[model samples]
Every structure is written in C-alpha cells, then in structure tokens.
Target: MLAAAPTNALPRWKGFNVLDFFNPDPKHRRQHTTQEHFRWMADWGFDFVRVPMAYPYYVRFDRSRPIMPHEVYQIDEQQVQHVVDLVEHANRCGLHVCLNLHRAPGFCINAGFEEPYNLWKDPEAMEAFVFHWAYWSKLFRAKTRDQISFDLLNEPCLREDMNDQFSQRSAVPKERYRSLIVKGCETIRASDPGHLVIADGNNIGNEVIDNILDLDVGQSCRGYAPGLVSHYKAPWVFEHPEHLPEVTWPSVENGQVHDKAWLREQFAPWIALVEQGGGVHCGECGAWKETPHHVALAWMDDMFSVLTEHDIGFSLWEFDGTFGILNSERKDVAYEDWYGQKLDRKMLDLLTKFV
Candidate 1:
C-alpha cells in the first residue's frame, strides 16, 4: 500500500470561498453572502470560509483610473464594517474565516483595471500591501487564532507582460515572494502575534514556497491542477477551450495525463513540506460548472482523498458561482429547488462526504 500523506500543523478544515467582493470594481460585485449561507455550511459539516476580497472594495480609490499611492489608505468605514460584520456572522456560525486580498495594491491575477504599481518589484505597492494587512490585523485583533486567519494574497505570481484574462502566469521570483511574505508576517505579528497567516503557493498556487520554511505561517495550494479537469472550458482561463480533447479521469485527456497517481504527484511537494514541519492546506479547489458533473465528482473524490489521507483540508473555489454548489449554472446538473435558488445536491452531497 502507498504511504499515507504526512500530517501537518494546520487543521483539516474543509470549506469554500465566498466571492462577495472578489472584484474591486463595484460593477462585478455579487450579492453579499448571507448569514444563512454560513449556517448552511456549518449545518452541512464544513468548518471554514475564505472571503476573497479586492482591496479596493473597502478602500476609497479613484475607480475610473489607476489608483494613486497617496490614495491607498483612504479607508471607507461602511465598507470595512460590512466585511467585519461578515466575519462576525461566520464566526458566530462556528466557522473559521481566512480573509484574502485577491486584488491588492499593485497586483492581481486577473486583468482589466490599470494598476499604477507592481507588487513584486515596486516599493510603493509593497507598502500599500502591508498597510492593508496591518490595518486588517489591528481591526480584527480581538479574535483568536482559531476564529480568524489572514490569507496574505491570492495566487501570487508575475504576469507583467501578459494582458487580458488569457495571459500565461509565471511564478513571482521566489526571493521577491519570500521578502514580501516575511515582511507581511512581521507586520501582522507585531499587532497580533498569534493570528494565523497563510501564503499561497508560488506559480498561482501550483508550487510550494520552499524558501520560507522558517516562517510559522501556513501555505495554501490550489486544486485545479491539470486545468483540463478543473477549468475545462473556463473562458477566463482558455482562449479556445472548445477545441480541447475529451476529459476523463484516471485516463489521458485535455492535453495532459489524468489519474489519481498524477494528482498525487502534483501535490507531492506540498506533502513533503508537511514532512519538513510546514502546515499545508488547499485554500481553493473544484472544477468549473461546465465540466461533466460525474467527471467533476470523480476527480474531486480522488483529489479529496489525496488531501484527506495527508490530513489536509480544502475550500471549494466558491459557494455560489461557476465553481460552486448554488446556482452554479451547470448544464448537466438536475439542481434542487433551494429557497428559490437552484442547488446542486449531488455536488453538495459529494462535499459533505469528505467533511
């Protein structure tokens, strides 16, 4: 039999990412997640919720153009309170919250808006990045480590030359990533020493951060490896996804091999990090809604099995979007009527099985 995956310091907290403010622009913001959603997640046996927020969502910045360095700290009290309230409600529902900066001062994995600075190379951007973390660290200082954690950034990488959503992602220089993380941790610890900080794996959560072994912060990994299986026809990720090969699990397809062994190999580095005394968790996981439902479930079963055997837990990309359970808009699913909204019971049931 294969060796069981190594154990780590982080909790095996399974959950989902609720994208209420994933986009910085007000136009893209979805309906804010309700208290009932958290209650349902807890009721369904999940224990974690990752709120991926755009920094500008709660800051006063000139939305029509690139943000100026001087405008980074203009905190909007109402917007900040909205996030604060969401945290409290989730905590009350007995959920652990890991708030993430999806769009930071000078960086974002997705493109469209003009960013006046570069997160990996510019000093000004770094300052604003830390400033927001510091501000959030202080604002939520009263919470215990188990109640709240901060995800430093979402999918850290260098896509400087790329344009539009189809651009290829390159890993941020490991040294630059290390530098920002070290300082990010230092700033947070300065105010709340016990608060947990998680850094996403480099290369858009594909590779582990081998350099920051000394830091106490946990590292987050992605579940969408073999994009053919996870993002199959995701328009944002593919320019011509329709031309892709047929997708299958434990078989070859999607321009790459796919199987439980391949999945395990992809996460082998993270499991090794656990052996080296680092805490690891999959901060995001799940195939897009368009992939055949049966295939998505099968892939997730193996993915969750790999993660579970290793004592690692994960958060699905969303609770109510293309990659989620509610109103996912999956053409293949027979959705259940859930409070006037459609629900993917099979997907929900599959998730509960792992929990």
Candidate 2:
C-alpha cells in the first residue's frame, strides 16, 4: 500500500500550473522563474505547482542520426541541475512541485509533436524512455518525498488513428503497460524510495482506471482530469450546430444545473481505483476562453467542490495564455470582460478552501 504523508507536511496539496519553465524562450533554454513565481503562487493560497518538462529539452535532439536521433537519449548534467535548482526554489517558497515528463524523448500524446512514442515496435526508443526515468530517479533522490513528485507521462493515449506502436493494433496489451509502469516505479523507488509517482490515464485522461484496477500496479495512480467544461468553446474542438444551445456549466439557463453531476460521474471509476490503494491527482483541469465568465465561475465552483469532496489534488491547465489565470497580454479584463470578471479575488477566495 502507498503510505500517507505525515500531518505536519505542508498538507500534501494545493497549486496551479508552471508552464513557462519547460517551454521557455529557446535562447533562455531551461532558465525559469526564481522566487517571484513561487511567492506569487504562495500568496494566491496555492501550495504546489506542476512543472511540465520535455525530455528532449534536457537532452540534445539531433535530426541527422540513424533510425532515431543520435543524441536523443543523452541527459546533460547542466540542464538537469537547472531543474534541480527550480525544485529547490519551489521548496524554499513552500510549494510542492511535480516534475512532469510532458514530452518524452520520442513522443507526445498532444499531436503537436512530429514523432510520438510507439514502444511496441521500437526497442531503442523504449530503452531510452525507461533510461530517462531511471536517470531522473537517480538525480532527485535527495529531495524530501512530499517536497517533490514525478508524473510519468503527460498523456499516453491509446487512440486508433495515431498510427503508432501503442495504437489499438500493435499496442502492448494493457497488462504490459502496467508492467512498464511497475518497472518505471521500481526504477524511481530504487533511488528515491519515497517520491510519489503519478501515472497518466490512457486515452488522454478519458480511460485507464479500469486497466489500473485490473492490472494492479503497486502504487497510488493519478491522472489529468481534462478541461472539457472550459474547452466547450475552444476553436480546435468542433461542436455540432445541431447540438446548439450548447450545454455548459452554470447553465445556459438560470435554474438548471449545468452538467456538473455528469462530470463528477465520469470520475467515478478513477475515484474507485483511488479507494483501492491508489491516490488521485487531477493533474489538469481548467476553463478556457470559450467559457462565459459567469459560467466559468460556476464551473470552477462546482469542480472545486467535487475535488475537495474527493480529496483530490488538482492543477489548473495553465498560468498564462488562452486558458490562463493570468493573461500574458495583461489586458484589463479581470473586472470588465465576463470571463475576466469571474477570475478575481472572489474566485481566488473560493479556491483557498482547498489550497
């Protein structure tokens, strides 16, 4: 069974996204925020920040190699130290940090990347993937268990159209994925026995609870909860015109309850898995620009309630940009725009309950 944190240990919770750290300026490379970001998060009543990192960023990605890139698997010590420094900074600011492998050496489930992992066929790629985790485990062995955690992959989807080794046809049976997860867990535990390992759900946070329960990987499992409520208005997502009078939280009408109950229902299986020795962290969940201001607030209110009720840790999708809490453009919409209006002190106050 997974052990629980002690009572005095920073509540094992609360925080938002730390997106800029990994996706930093190409020139700046790994250089990210110091005290300011942590202090700001602390001030906002957040106790943690999920830092999504790409493996290729730390290692050189050479396009001139053979099958896979030649330098694709090597980890640079200097780059690794930069990440270590960020963790230490986070600790100093009293923030829990989750080192997320957002983009692995060969794959990103996000579709924006050119090559995604197809572990079933590529032996070299699989070795690199496992080796990367092993390397990280060795590097971060010194940090306090609760002070940091590791998210295995951002989203390992089992989609049919991706045409990768992990697709429906050539996919490692669900049992094999469990074994890989165990191997990854064992690798980390061998070095840093106490650090938490968060395993992403399959189908991009849509499935895997069933697999997790059935396979029985010996650790607490967690996953990204997604931003369906907030993404109803995202341009990338197509909504049928026939399905108009779009359904949203806070309701399109006044009295009806927006689909909060259904959203919670979707989490039922994962909640059950958590009940059975696994822990849950809703790694990604947020409202996007498409959601109306009042509706977004209402959605957050409901979402927060459910998360708190279930005692799940969550991180908003981002800090700045489209679905961001802080808009990068610094527009004065916080008080004016409907969406902006919902993102003020009042919303922060509500979020404080969990943080």
Candidate 3:
C-alpha cells in the first residue's frame, strides 16, 4: 500500500558488519579491514558493509574522565575526514556503507564503560547523542544515499526513565522510547534529508516498536532469536554454557518452537512498518562460531529464506573472526585460502545460494 518502502535504495543482497575492523584504537582498526577485504566481498556477490564505530574514536575527548552533565563534545576534524575517506574507499571498491554508532556518549550495550548519566534520562547525554548525528549530517550532507547512509544508534536498550538495560517483562513504554529516537532523527533530518537514516529496534534490535512510523526513517532488526540455536555455548551471551541444555533448529524451546512460523511471527512487527512505507533491514544476524556449522546453516536457511521472501535487506553479523563467513574460527568449518585469508567454501557456497 505504501509503495513497498521505496525498494530499499541500498542493496538488498547479503552484507557483513565490520565491527572489530573499525576499533577505537587507530592502529588496530586500520589493520583489520583491508583493501583485500573489500575486494573479497565484491567478488563473492556481496556489496554492502555496515561499519559499527565507537564515537570516542572520532572525537577529541578524554576517555578516562567522566562525561560532565553539560559537557560540550568536540569532533576531531581529521577523524571525521577519515570516515568520509573510508566511505569513499568503500564506494570505490563497489560497496555501499552504512555508518553506525556502536557506542555513543551515554549508552552502549557492552558493560565496560560507565556513563556519568543515563542517555535515555539525561538531557545532556541525549544532547550529545543528537550532536554526534548532527555533526556527521553536516559533514556528509552531500553524499548520495547509494554511497552511504547513517545508522543513528546501535541497539537502543536503555529503559525509558533509567539508563539501564531493557527487560522484556519490565521496560519503558514503546512511545516513550520512540520520542527519544524522534529527537535524534529530527536533528539529523533537519540538516541532511537526503541520506537514508536507520534506527535499530530496542532489545538489541530484536523487538521492533511502532514508534518509528512517523520518523521517515528506515528500521533495522536483529536475527539472533532462539539464542540456544544461534548462540549456544557463546560465553558473551551465556554465563554457563555447560549448564544449558542442548539446542536444535526448529526445536521447541520453552514451548516456543524455533521454526519458520515462529520466525515469521517475530518479523511481523517490522514487516508492518515496511508496509507502512518505512524501510526495514535485518541490521545484524549471524550465529556464533561455537554453534555447529550444519545447525547454523539450517537455522540461517530458514531465517534468511523468510527475510528474502519478504524482500528485506540484511547484513550478516560480521565479515571475519568468530561469526564471519570468511575464515571464521569455527571448529567445524573447513577453511581454504581465498584472497590470502582462510576462506570457508562451504559457508560461501551456502551464502551465495541465497544471493
């Protein structure tokens, strides 16, 4: 009815998240994603890249000091230019880039840093968050949507009134969270209206809320459902994998089966938004290398099949390392050399099948 969300101006085919490749540490970040990496993606029938960047890496602020309530942040001109340069390079390599903020001034999913105030509740923190987007919009306002787009925030998990993790049983009202997101989107849109804006759903992008409908932006969803199937034995998600029971694809977990029907139900929320003229993307989706390759493929096949059938665009969790398609350190995957790095032919074959 709403023109099918404008055909997702960006590529709809498979892509990867460049998480560690853009580390805050300059030397380390520079080393991970290389020209070969970009070339490999293009050659392998993939052309999209989502770069999850930490704000501190591009700003000139004291990492050790706590954020002041009214602290005015400053963007490093050189670092800003570096991002523009990186985007240009990616474009040159025939890839469209989705610039994302994995860590913002007041919020982050990871538990390493402590914010002076909760971003969701603190006006100053929200101001800084908006300012970051505003800065980028002003700098890259001229860029076309095909070359790049801005992902406003990564998994916004902060509760409505408190800067804490979101709990499914007890969480902020969806409208309240949407209002906070609206402010940031307004700030970006007021300056740069051309570049597509993407907002991740709450609860690590797993739950898509209706609040985003009026914002004139794209919505991003998560793919790691039925954690038992996607993240089995992954230490980051499970405190004690040894204590957890075994998992199987399309198997019943807690009475809810991880089957195609269940998967579609999870996606129904965002699909409604997509029908309402909002772009929807599976911003992140991939199984941890610890999962059995065969099982992972089966689950992915079901998940990806539904997403593709619905004409939804998605990017896999990563390009390399634990969850990547290329040379992932999975115990079960046999690897060979492709572009000088270990390549998983089986994984590649499976991934390309969908493409």
Which model is ahead, 2 or 3, in terms of lDDT? 3
> Candidates' TM-scores?
0.96, 0.78, 0.88
Candidate 1 vs 2: which has more TM-score: 1
Whole-model Cα lDDT of every candidate shown, in order = 0.88, 0.62, 0.75
Clashes of each: 0, 1, 0
Residue 151's C-alpha lDDT in candidate 2? Answer: 78
TM-score of 2: 0.78
lDDT tens digits, residue span 197-297, model 3: 88888767877666666667777888988788778898767777889887678798767667988989888877766666667888899888888888888
> Could you give the C-alpha RMSD of every candidate to the true structure, in order shown?
2.1, 5.8, 3.3
Candidate with best TM-score: 1
Please provide, for model 1 over 43-162, each residue's C-alpha lDDT reduced to its tens digit, 9 standing for 90 to 100.
Answer: 999999999998888878778677777887898888889899899989999999999999898888888766777888789899999999999999999999889999999998888453
Rank list by lDDT: 1, 3, 2
Evaluated against the true structure, the overall lDDT of model 1 is 0.88
Best by lDDT: 1
